[model samples]
Target: MKLFVDCKKAGHLCDKGQYEDASFFEKLSVRMHVMMCKQCAKYSERNAKLTKLLKDSKCKQMPEECKKRIREELARELAKKPE
Candidate 1:
């Protein structure tokens, strides 16, 4: 198994770890990368904070009809734009 990872892989692993989807090796790679890369460490920290804030917030889900309408509107707008 690879013991080291780049910043991009670290970011992806961090996201997967947050959702409990990363493997043990993937989590270890991310931890090692974050320990050495300050930027990635900060990125991981902010990602965790954002996840916590969103989880704690009492945000309601938008209705499916509303989401469909918004998507339709965006499609229409994009279709009207010149290539």
Candidate 2:
């Protein structure tokens, strides 16, 4: 029920807000804190940019075959380790 939140809490809320995970009150608290705190404002701006960039980036996932090979290699290496 706390309307006012500290910088740390605001930052956490800001992160959650980016992912659409924060509730209405949480988002409101972050907006309120960011309005008065320049540092948090900048942090929120940069975080937003980062999130946008990542979302816009068409990243491809590694092939499952390649992942399976890597896992097999890791298991083989681990099995060679002395007890």
Candidate 3:
């Protein structure tokens, strides 16, 4: 595996790390990339902050049934409207 990753891959790895989903090598590569890239370092910092805030918030997801109902209602309403 490469010792370094690009900014895009680093960002992806950062997200995975946020959820504790990234493997050790992936995390290492991303960290190495961040160390070399100033922009990625900043991005990683913000991502970590966001992840911490989300975890602390104890937020819940809206049910899929409710989302489907909302979508169906919106579609019906849009269909009734004249363009």
Give Cα-based local distance difference scores for all models: 0.93, 0.95, 0.92
Best by TM-score: 2
Per-residue CA lDDT of candidate 1, range 1-83, in tens?
67898898899999998898999999999999999999999999998998899889999999999999999999999889687
Q: Which candidate ranks first by lDDT, i.e. highest? A: 2
Off by over 4 Å in 3: 81-83
Q: What value does the lDDT take at residue 26 in candidate 1?
A: 93
TM-score, every prediction = 0.73, 0.84, 0.72
**Cα RMSDs, all models:** 4.2, 2.4, 2.4
Put down candidate 3 lDDT per residue, 1-83, tens digits, no spaces. Answer: 77788888889999999999999999999989988999999999999999889888967999999999999999999889586
Error of 1 at 55 (Å): 1.0
Give me the displacement of residue 2 in model 1, in angstroms. 0.8
Give the distance in Å from residue 33's predicted Cα in candidate 1 to where it truly belongs.
0.9
Which residue pairs come into collision in candidate 1? none
lDDT of 2 by residue, 1-83 (tens): 68999999999999999999999999899999999999999999999999999899999999999999999999999899697
Question: How many angstroms is residue 40 displaced in model 2 relative to the true structure, after the best TM-score fit?
Answer: 0.6
By TM-score, the better pick of 1 and 2 is 2
